[model samples]
Target: MSKPPLIPFSTTLFVRDTCLCLHVQRAARALARRFDEALRPLDITNGQFSLLMSLNRPEPPSMSAVASLLAMDRTTLTAALKPLERRGLLETFVDAQDRRLRRLRLTETGERLLAEAVPIWKQTHAAIDAHLGEAASDRLRAELLALT
Candidate 1:
């Protein structure tokens, strides 16, 4: 019987060192945890807060658009929206122009909640930036954007 080839634990040094997906996922989870705690008082999770902020823009986006922006699938977006809709923080309506499409709109309560959450978000953002340093943080954000 021939002996099997020996494989080192870290056989691929480059792959081990530069695993962007794993690093991004770990960092994202950590950041989400911090934001979730900060936004708890507003009764929103980090994901919900991001969805609301995306919807807060001048144009009320369709469900598809919102999903695209969040990089979520329709089913995932639907699941996320249910709790917000139940909490009266958001409303979905059939677009008049395109009856097939559903549009997401922030409710009055949602706006109020977002307003309350903004200061907390600012605090979180500032703390992160301070920890990372302004230039380094900005560069990190730019690099992340480039990857996306």
Candidate 2:
């Protein structure tokens, strides 16, 4: 009986350097942290800011629609909405036309917070694009969208 071989540090380095998933995940976390810090005074995480922004529409979106757009499951979306609901930043209501569906709406406070966060998002996003090079950033965004 013999033990299996241990993974090598070189193999780990190879994956760290070449794995798209690892790189994307790391980049996502880094970007989230940067946006989170910029958005902290508004008391919202980056995810919450995106969630609230998705709700900024002439007509409120149904829970299903929001879940789809956020690429999250309904249960996860519901859980995410809880904090905002508690803070009175958003509300859920039974859809008027569709009795069974729940729709989400940003409260006045949510709109105000989102309005404030927009500038921070723009500045951070512009810096990211500028650092990446405008053409490269555009192409990267297109490539990423293709993945989705």
Instruction: Please report the candidate that would top TM-score against the real structure.
Output: 2
Candidate 2 per-residue lDDT, tens place, 12-85, comes to 89999999999999999999999999899989999999999999999999998999999999999999999999
**Ten-residue region with minimum lDDT total, candidate 1:** 7-16
Q: What are the per-residue Cα lDDT tens digits for candidate 1 across 36-143?
A: 998988778999999988889786899999999999999999999999999999999999998999999999999999998889999999999999999999999999
Report the poorest 10 consecutive residues by lDDT, candidate 2: 2-11
What's the lDDT for residue 122 in model 1? 93
lDDT of each: 0.91, 0.94
**In model 1, what lDDT does residue 123 have?**
94
Clashes of each: 0, 0
Which residue pairs show collisions in model 2? Answer: none
